[model samples]
Target chain A: MRELLRVAPGGAVDLGAVDPRSTPGLPGREVTGPQRKEWARGQLTLIGAELGRQQEMLFAEAKARQSAARPVGAAAGGGGSDAAAGGAGGRRVLLVLQAMDSGGKDGTVKRVAGAMNPLGLHVRSFGPPTPEELRHDFLWRIRRALPPPGYVGVFNRSHYEDVLVARVESLVPESIWQARYDEINAFEREQADAGVALVKVFLHISYAEQGRRLLERLDEPRKHWKYDPSDVDARARWDDYQAAYAEALGRCGTDAAPWYVVPADRKWYRDWAVAHLLRETFDTLDLGYPPAGFDVRRERERLLGSERTA
Target chain B: MRELLRVAPGGAVDLGAVDPRSTPGLPGREVTGPQRKEWARGQLTLIGAELGRQQEMLFAEAKARQSAARPVGAAAGGGGSDAAAGGAGGRRVLLVLQAMDSGGKDGTVKRVAGAMNPLGLHVRSFGPPTPEELRHDFLWRIRRALPPPGYVGVFNRSHYEDVLVARVESLVPESIWQARYDEINAFEREQADAGVALVKVFLHISYAEQGRRLLERLDEPRKHWKYDPSDVDARARWDDYQAAYAEALGRCGTDAAPWYVVPADRKWYRDWAVAHLLRETFDTLDLGYPPAGFDVRRERERLLGSERTA
Candidate 1:
C-alpha cells in the first residue's frame, strides 16, 4: 500500500495510470487529456466517499469503547484494538512549512487534515513573534505548537522560517542564520526521538502562476480586498526564496522529518498529494475496529433517553 | 416568497409554506426536527448551501473577469456578476466567547461554521496574550481577529474575557473593567455601522452539564488530557460568570449585533441555533446566482486549451 501511493513527479501520481475503468473499486477509468481530468475528479469523489465511511466507522467504534469502560490501552493500538478508532495518548505529528501566504497552505490543510477528527487536529499558523516569543529561544514558538500524544499538529510556516526567510531577506546576519540549520536538525531529531512524526512540505509554484493568481485577485472587485501589492515585492525575490528552500530541504531532509518537495503549481495535484501523504501516515498505524463484547446499542439507547418522555 | 416561508405561531397565511416532500425545484428533504431545533437545522442547511453556491459562483465569475480585462462591477448584477451573485465586499462578522477548560468553543466552530467556504472564513482562538498585546488596551488582541472584507472570523474567547473573566476572578478592579462594557459597545457599534454583521452567542450550559462533560473528560482516558483541575476553581464562580453575561447581553444586545442567549445545555440545540443565526444573517443579504451571459464555458475552455497541443 505504501509503495503504491509513492509521491511521483508533479507531486502526485498520474491518475491515468489507475484507469478507473479498469481499476476495480475505484470510480473512473484511465483516459487521456480532459478525460484524465475527469478521472482525477472521480477519484477524488471516491476518496471523499471512502473517507466518510471510515470516519463513521471510527466514530461508532470509539463511542462503543467509551460505553464499555475500556482501559486506555484498549483505546490505543497496543491491545490489538483498532488503532484508527483509538487515541494517540503520546503520539505526535508535526507539520512544518515556510511562509504560508496564499501559496496553497490553507488549501493543503483543507484537503489533507480536513477529515481528521477536530479534537485530534491542531493548527498553529505563525506570524511575527510576540515580545515574549522573541525573548525566548528562537525555537520556543515551534516547540509550543507541537501536538500532544495521539494528535496531529500542523505548523503553517514554522521555525525553519527563522532560517529561510530571515536568511533570504538578511533580516538576521548570515553568521546567525547559517549555523541554525544544524541547530534545527538537532531540535527536530529530539522531537522524532520523543515519538513525534514530522512531515515537512515545500509548496513549489512558478512565479508566473502566482502572478496570475494575484492578478485574478485584483481583477475581481470582491477579491480586491484580499490584494496586497507588497506580495509582488516578495515575488521579485523568487530566486532567493528558491535557493533558501533548496538549502533548507537539503539540510533538514532526514528520516526524522523527511521533506516532500511538492510541485504546487497545480492546486489539484498539491491537494491530492497532501491527502495521500496523510492517508499513508495514518495507514501505517494499522488502525482497526475495537474488540468485541461491548453493547453499543444499549448505551446509545440509554443516552438517547429510551425511558424519557419525548 | 418571504411570507410563505414565515410561520406565525397561530396566524393564518395566504400561501402555504413550501412543502419539502413535494417541492420539485428543491432536492430531497431530510426530516429537520421540531420547533426551535427544526428552525435551527433548516436555516443552517439553507445557509450552508447558499454560501457554497455563492462562493463557487464568485470564483467562476472572478476567473472570467480576469480573462476579459473587466472590473467585477461590470459583471455585477448580471449572471456571474458580484452583486447578482451576492458577492458583496467589505462585510465582516466575528464570534466571541469566554472559556474554561473543555468549553465547547471548538465544537461550536466545527458544527456551526463547518460548511462555510474556507476562503471566506478565519478562526482565531485566543490564549494568554503576549506582552505586545498586554502593553496596548485589552481589546488589542481581539481587534486584530476581526475579519477582512467579505469574510467571517470567529474568536473563541475574545475581548469580553477581559471584563467577564477578569472581573469575576478579581484580576482587574471594578472601575476599570466596569467601564469596558461601554467601550465594547462602542467598538461593536462602530463595526456594525461599518457594515459588519456580528452575532454573539452565549452557550448557556448549566453547571451540572459542565460537570458532566468534565467528568466524561476525566473518565475517558483519551479525554483525560483535557481535564484540567484548575477548571473547578473557575466552575465555582459560575454564578458570577452568568451574572456578567446577563448584564453584558442586556446592555449590548442591539439591532446591529444582537446577542443570542442560546440554551447550550443541549449541544445539538446550540449547534443548530448558531447555524440558524448564520443562515438568517446571510439570507438577509439576498445572495443569488450571478447575472447571466458571463460565458463561463469560454473562460474554462481557454484555461484548458481549445485544442490538444501535444
Candidate 2:
C-alpha cells in the first residue's frame, strides 16, 4: 500500500496517469459500493487504534528520556539496562496534507490523525500568509510549527503552497517560484537528519468530484460558509494547478520526504490509506515503553509505604 | 449535569466530603458495574458527535467573520438580507484539565476532546515551568496558549498548577501563592471578556486509587515509562495536594470560569462528564454556518460554467 501511493523520488508525476477513484490496496476490489466503504471504515478503526498506540509509545519514550535526566541513574545506578537513557530514540513524524478546495484535507485529518492523542499530536493549518508572515521568508512560519522531538506534527496545506499557489496564480516571479523546488528538498533533508520523518500527502480528487463537492457546499445551508466565490475562480484554472502539482510532486519527491498521492474522490479509501500509511511509518520506529528510570523494587516499596526513599 | 459537577464560585471545598466513585448524572445509579460503564460510553459517543459538529461550526463562523471583512457586504451589497453579514458570531471555548497522577486526565481527553476536529482544536500541555518561564508571571504561558477567535483550546495542566503544585511543594513563598488566587480570577475574567468561555475540570481521584494506578504502571511493562519515582513522593503528600486543590477550586471558581470536579475514580464517568460539559458549553454558542458571502445564484452559475463572474 505504501509503495503504491508513494511518488518515486525524481520520477515524473503525471496526475492524469493515475485514476483518482482507484482503491489500489483494497482487498478484493470485487466488493463494490457500500460493502467497500464498510470495509474501509472497519480497517480504519483498527489502523487508527494502532496509530494511537504508537503515538503513546512515542510520547512515553520521550517522557522516560526526559525524566531519566533526574536523580535515579547517577546515585542508584538505575535498575534495568535501558533505564538510564530510555528505550526508544527521539524520532518525530510530520505529515503534510495538500489539496484543492473541498479535496477532503479536513476530513482525512478528522478520520486518520484524529486517532492519535492530541497530546502527542500538533495539527497546524496554514492559510494564506498574513501580513507579518509575508514579511518573513515563507519557511519562517513553517519552521516554527514543526513538531518537537516526540510529537506527530501535521501541516494542512503547508510550504508546498509556496510552489503550488505561487506558480498557478503568479503570486511570485517565475525565477522565484521555480527556485523553491530545490529549496524545499534541501529544507526537508535537514529535517530528516534532525529526526523528522516527513510524510507529504496530496489528496487527489477528480475535476468532476471537485465540482460536485462545491455544489454540495452551495446547496446545504450548514455548508454555505465553506463556499467561497474565489473557489470558482480557482476551479477555472484547475489544469494549471494540476500541472503545477505534478511538477512540484515530481521535483520535490525525495527519500527524506516523499509525497503520497491518495485517491481522495472516495473519502473512505482516502481516510484508510492515510491512516494505514501513518501506521506503517510509526511501525518502523521500534517504539516501546522505556525500562524503569528508577529501581522498580525501590519505587514499589516507596509507593506501598509512606516513608523516605531507600 | 453542569450544575451537579460545578464547584460554586467562592464556596468552600472539602475533598473528603465527596465520594470519588460516585457517578453523577448517569441515569439510575442502581445499575452498577459494567452496565453503568457501558451506558456512559454509549452516551459519550453521542455527546462526542455533538461536540464535533459544534467545533466545526465554531471554525466556520470564524472563517465567515474573517472573509466577511473582504468584498461581499461592502460591494454589490452581497446577495439578499443577511447575505452581506455572516450569521454566526465569534466565540471560542477553552477546556482546562487538572489532576493528580492517575486521575484519568489523559484518558478523558483521549475519549472526549479526541472527538472534535483537531483543526479547530489546540491541545497544549504545560509541564513543570522552564527556567525562562519562571522569570515571567505564572499566567504568561497560559495567556500565550489561549484559544484564538475560532479555536477550541485545551490545557492539560494549566495555571491552576501554580496554586496546586506551588502551594503543595512550597516552590513559591506563601505570600506569592496566596495572592495568585485573585490574579488567576482577574486573568480568566479578561479572557472571558475577549470571547473565551473557560471550562475548568479537576479530575478528582482518591489517594488509594492513585496508589493502585501507580502499581499498575510498575506492573505493566508497556506502562513503566509513565511511572516516575517522584510520583510516589507526590503521593506521600496526598493530603497537602488535596487541601491545595480544594482551596484553589473554591477561590478560582467563578461565573466566567467555573471549576467542575469530575469524580475520576471511574474513568467512564470522567470522560462522559467532560464531553457532556463541552457539548453544553458549545450548545449555548448558538453556532451555525454563516450566510452565503457571495451571490449563490452567480456562484452556482460560475461553478457550472468555467467562465468569468456574472
Candidate 3:
C-alpha cells in the first residue's frame, strides 16, 4: 500500500500522469458510487482509531524520555538499530502538504488531524512570507515551526511553495528556486538525521476538480469569506502549477522523506489515504516509555516527612 | 497582594534588605508552626484556581481575536483604548527568572507554573550559549523563544545571566557585561511596544537557605542527579552573585516590564506569590474572543449539499 503511493528517492513522478480519482490501496477499480465509499469509510474508521493509539504511544514515549538527550553523532538515515537518539523522546513528525488552490489541504487537517489530541499536534499554515521571514534564509521560518519532540506537526503549505510558486509565478529568478530543490533535499536529510520522521504529501487534484471546489466556495455565502479572487488568477496558470509539482516530487523525494502523491479529488478518500500514510510512517519508529530513573520509595518518605511542614 | 510583591518601575530595591523568610502577601508575620504552613497552602490553592481561570480567559480571547492584528504603533506600556493591534491575539507574557544556585527555580516551575495549562505555557531553560547562539546577538535566542500571541512563557533563567553571571564570573569583561543592563531594558521596551507583557522575577534566597537546599539535594538519594559539584563553586561566590542580582533587578526594571523580588526561603509562599503575581499581570490585558466572521448558516447548507456525496 505504501509503495503504490510513495515516490521513490530520485525517482521520476509525472504529476499530470497520475489520476486524482484513483485510490491506490482500495481493491477493484470497478467498484464505484456509495459502495466504494462505504469501503473507504470502514477503512477510515479503523485507520483513525489506530492512528490515535499510535499518537498516544508516541506522546507517552516522549514524556518518559524527556531528560534523555540524543547520543552525539547518531548515524544519519538507515541505521539498522531500532534505537534512535533523535527518535527517542525528541523525535517528531513534520507532515508537509503542498498542492494547487482548492486542493483540500485545510480540509484534510480539519477532518483527519482534528481527530488527534490537540496537545500533541501543532498545525501551522504558511501563506506568503512575512517581511521579517523574507529577510532570513528560505528555511528559517519553516525550521522555527518544526514540531518539538513528541509532536505531530502539520504544515498546511510548506517550504515547497518557494520552489513551486516561485517557479510558476516567476516570483524569483530561476537560479534561486532552481537551487532550492537541492537545498530542501539536504535540509530534510538533516532533519531525518536529527530524529525527525518527515512526510511530504502532494495533494494531487485535477484541474477540473479545483474549478468545481472554487465555484462552490463562490456560490456559498458562508464560504465567500474563504473565497479569494486571487485563486482565479492562479487557476489561469494551472498547467504551470502542474509542472511545478511534477518537478518538485521528482527531484526532492529522498530516502529520508519521500513524497506521497495522494489522489485528492474526493475529500473523503484524501483524508482516509492521508490517515493511512501517517500510520505507515509512524510504524517505522521504535518508540517506548523510558525506564524509571528515580527511586520512588526514598522520595516518598522525604516528601511526607519534615519537608511537608518545613 | 500584587503591589506588595512588585518592584515599581525604576524604584530602588535593596535585595539585601528583604527577608527571604517573609511572606509579604500573607498576614501576621508573627504566626508560626503548622498553622502558618496551612495558611500559606490555603492561599496557594486560592491563587492557583484564579490563575487557572485567568489563563483560560486569555487563551479564549486570543482565539477570538486571531485575525485582528495590532494596530500599527499602538501606545507602549499604557493605553486607555480596549482595542490594541498587538493585544488582539498576540499579547503574551514572558516571565524572566534570575536567582543564585539552589534558589528554587525548578521548584517554582514545578509548583506554580505546573498549575497553569501546559497548552498555553512554554518553558525554556537557557544554559551556556552554544556556538551558533554565541554567533548571534545575545538577544537572538531569547527573541526566538518569545511565546507567540496568547501564551504564558517562562524563562527559567534569562538574558539577565549575560550580565549577572557574565559580570560576577568574569565570563565577559566588565566593559561588556556593564553595557547589557541598558541593552536589556531597551530590548524589553521593544517587546512592550509589540504587545508582549513582560515580568521579571528574582528569586531572592538568603545564603543560609541556599546552603540548606543544596544540603538537602545531597542528602536525598533521589535528588543526587540534580546536584552538581559546580553548584558548590557558584555557592563559594555567593556575595558576588547577590551583588549581580541587585544591579540587574535595579537597572532592568521599567514601565514595560518591572522586576519583582520574590522571597524564596519558604517554598510554599514563593510559589503562591509568583502565581498571584502572574494573575495580576494577565489582568492588565483587554482580551476577548475574536468576533465570528464566517456565515454559519451558509456553511451548514454547503456541508449538507452535493459536496457531501462528491
Residue-level error in angstroms, candidate 3, position A125? 6.8
Task: Give interface RMSD, per candidate.
Answer: 14.3, 8.8, 14.0
User: How many steric overlaps does candidate 1 have?
Assistant: 18
lDDT of 3 by residue, B1-310 (tens): 6578777656446787899998887767566766887877787778867776676566555544543343422212111112112223367787777777778776686567656655455566665565577788889888766766666778877788788767877876788888888899898988988778887888889877877776676566544545444465566677777777777777777778888888999888888788878878877875443333444555445433423232
Candidate 1 regions with alpha-carbon error over 4 angstroms: A1-107, A116-197, A202-252, A261-273, A279-310, B1-46, B52-90, B98-103, B117-120, B127-136, B148-150, B192-195, B283-310
Top model by DockQ, which number?
2
Q: State the interface C-alpha RMSD of candidate 3.
A: 14.0
Clash pairs of candidate 2?
none
TM-score of each: 0.55, 0.92, 0.56
Arrange candidates, best DockQ first.
2, 1, 3
| Candidate 3 lDDT tens digits, A21-115 | 98788776666777888787777878877776677667555644543343422211111111112233368777888778779786786567755
lDDT of each: 0.54, 0.80, 0.69
Poorest stretch of ten by lDDT in candidate 3 chain B: B75-84
As a whole number from 0 to 100, the lDDT of residue A126 in candidate 1 is: 57
Mark the regions of model 3 whose C-alpha exceeds 4 Å error after superposition.
Answer: A1-128, A132-140, A144-186, A197-310, B8-12, B26-90, B110-123, B131-145, B148-150, B212-227, B265-268, B293-310
Tens-digit lDDT track for model 1 on B1-310?
2121222322222121222122121222554334545555675677666655554443444433332444443321111111111222345566654434455666787666666554345555554444466688988666655664445667666777777666777767899998998898899888887657786766666555666676675455444433333355566666676677656666666666666555556665566656666656666655443332333344433433322233
Candidate numbers, best TM-score first, in rank order = 2, 3, 1
Off by over 4 Å in 2: A29-34, A70-89, A307-310, B29-34, B71-89, B307-310
